[model samples]
Target: MNIPMFTLLVGIPLVSSPVVYLFGRLTTRAQVLTRQGWIVRLLALLAVVATWFPFINLWLEFQARGRRMFFNIESIWLQLDGISFLLAAMVLTLGTLAILFSGRYMAGDFGEEKYYAMLLAMIGLMIGLGCANDLFNLWVWFEAMAVSSYLLVAFYREQPGSLEAGMKYVVQSAVGSALALLGIALVLAQTGTLDMDQIRLMVGTMDLNKAGLLAAGALFFIGFGVKVAMVPLHTWLPDAHSQAPSGISAMLSGVVIEAGLVAMLRALSTLTGFALSWGWLLLAFGALNMLYGNLLALQQSQVKRMLAFSSLSHIGYILMGLGIALVSGQPAGAQGAAFHLFTHMLMKGLAFLAVGAVMYALFHEQGIHRPLVAHDLNGISTRYPWVALSLSIALLALGGLPPLAGFMSKWQIFVAGFQSGNGWLMGFVVFAAVNSVISLAYYAPLVNRMYRRVTATSVKKGSASISWTMQLPLLLMALAVVVIGLFPSLMNWLTEPAGAALMSIFR
Candidate 1:
């Protein structure tokens, strides 16, 4: 028997979560500073690293055999294709880096073990979602990811607003999940199938109730839209992202929402008439998200809150590409969306980790954890040169500046939009372009502040230095952002096939 690569890919971390918790329970806070705590930290990190073997093997197998893989064991169906492979790679790469950074950044924090556990579980569930070939399995993974993330958001239970944010997140997510489940029920009732490929075939061939399909589409849009942070449904994001620990914030802003969009795309793919039913709506919402999110981000002085809003704007960029794909039936839009998803993970993940490093340094200096304001970063570059530099790179890339990962990704999306050749969609693309420039209004100023001189009152009296564990992820991600920008073709092998896989459902 093969090693069950897909199963192990998700199982490694999922199983490790409890083991880490058990080990964590054995160590006291003081013991955590000692060898005992290091044991727990290593356990968490090694579990994440261990998954790499299976992932690499799966990728190699995928390449050698063909473009796809499928598994059926114990009645669970798993599909591995370009889309799942791309998403799983993103989840594993970012999850590993975030957990590694946590080894240092989360050190000595209470329940440090639980933090690692939840993070791993969330990553595992996300990967499961990417690979799920059944509707119910996808929802299970989605809900499980949400539950684990909720706990993470409220991790600092004693913090003033952490619990409040968690409450809001859970409530909204529960509602969204309910709506999504209802959508699934409708589909299952009409077609008598939970398998995505079968559902696609049935919908295409059978004359199902048109009204039920329309209702399913609406339900799914609203359900997944909340996670995608589409304007009207995005109320929970800023609070949740701002309240979560910095590393978790990076995961949430970076890959979690991207996973939600994938779930939405998969569900929508099973139904017909997406171009007529949802394309225009997605375009309108995409425009709103870009403008509204950018405008809000511009007004934020708090660092994490600003980044939270920025994620929404970037989500808008991605949705516009996907929307164009649906409307025009072109693969370029989907390809661009897929490419941008990969780059956004790198750019935003770097940004949050870099910001987290600063906060970690600040905590050591001040003996307290507090929200970081942009103004506090003034003159920070003089002391924490590497962190300051990495943050700047992240900010510039996010603003879609040239020769950076963000630039290339955004360029692909814009080109996809233009290629639609529909005057109206072309106009929407132009609007997205203007919003991209508008985003820099905030991004540029933040980068500028990092280099400016600070007043004596604003400066910390003690030297603030970041640990190498945290610094390594920052540099690695920053390098990726720069390298990918300059050489976009390097990722084409993955992005092209992933795009084709996604568009295949349409055909």
Candidate 2:
């Protein structure tokens, strides 16, 4: 039987998840555990790859038709528009590389079968959340993704830090979900419908309860703010990102938080006049996030923990672009935000995966799995030249250095702010630029340590070869950062439409 594009997009991974577990069960009885794990990993990778077809087809259709498409059943709507397509594509691409990296990274870990299963489930749910057009259904997808991710975060149940981090993540996420649900309930009570389009029309035409709508908007902001790691609501991120497996770390910092941003944007679109009030609120929060994230990262000695904090600062940049877009209705701001979202997934994903490769090498060489301190990377360039190079590129790009994707992405946002001709917004743009320079204080040290000389007192640099599986993803992403940096126009096809889609709400 033929399945709808939306169903197929969500179904491929969800359906493959269980089948992978059953394969694990069968392989256990028929083969050795090592072989069984490889089989499971292979199957999981194929399942993620299978998702590409539907996404590509849908994207082609959108490009050719140049319009949004909807799939409706009663009040439940799953729509394919520029933003949804961009987000879905991000989820699949990053999810695929993370899963592939997992093949070697998670090979001997306990519960290999469950690891792949939960990862796939989270990917599918994130896609659903992006495409969902009904408020209640969006919440359902959000919760489902949270459930799957919580398990993955605590996959190393034997480790105290892992369990502690997972508990923090689940508790904070549950409360955020509750707030979002409450906001949805208020929206439903106000309009008697959860359909976003219907609510938009009702809110625009009807004499609604302004007080009630404002309350819902506030709730939505705080609820989604937790996941976006916006300052003050961002306490849960450092532990969750640092404690989880490196592959999961890439997903959390790279795509997952961005998904939260998209969800918040979609929710806000349903509430008329929210942009006028919330737009400046985003700018204030953006500035706070930048300062908070940068200062905290400077204090971190652990590599992953530092990277986790840097994510907050990058999120702040995206928020600034989005804020400008909302307040001034300039397509440049929205476009910059969209472009940065794409660039960040590459830059950050490469950083984590490259660092994870070093961790993996050390584990195999020294039998240690503890958190890697930044100093531990000293003289690593001599032992692992390729990985050292990859990590340096990632760090430099993330620091917004010239001739890297990060530089171009930040440039776009700065240009957007200046083009608005608002003196205050332009000042924020200067603040963001200075923060970008200050960020290198921490980023540069990590790169410096990698190439520093190994002394008699320094940690041992063992000869542990990084497998092709891990190195492949790192190299590919590093190339992408350079290529995109050189050719910024290459991504306009995706970012332009997304910006247009976002502006549609304002019109």
All models, RMSD in angstroms = 1.7, 1.7
Query: Which candidate has the highest lDDT of all?
Result: 2
lDDT of 2 by residue, 358-462 (tens): 888886346676998887788888878889998999999999998999999999999999999999889999999999999999999888888875721234555
Clashing pairs in 1: none
* Clash count of each predicted structure: 0, 0
Provide the lDDT at 92 for model 1: 88
What is the overall TM-score of model 1 with all chains considered together? 0.97
Model 1 shows how many backbone clashes? 0
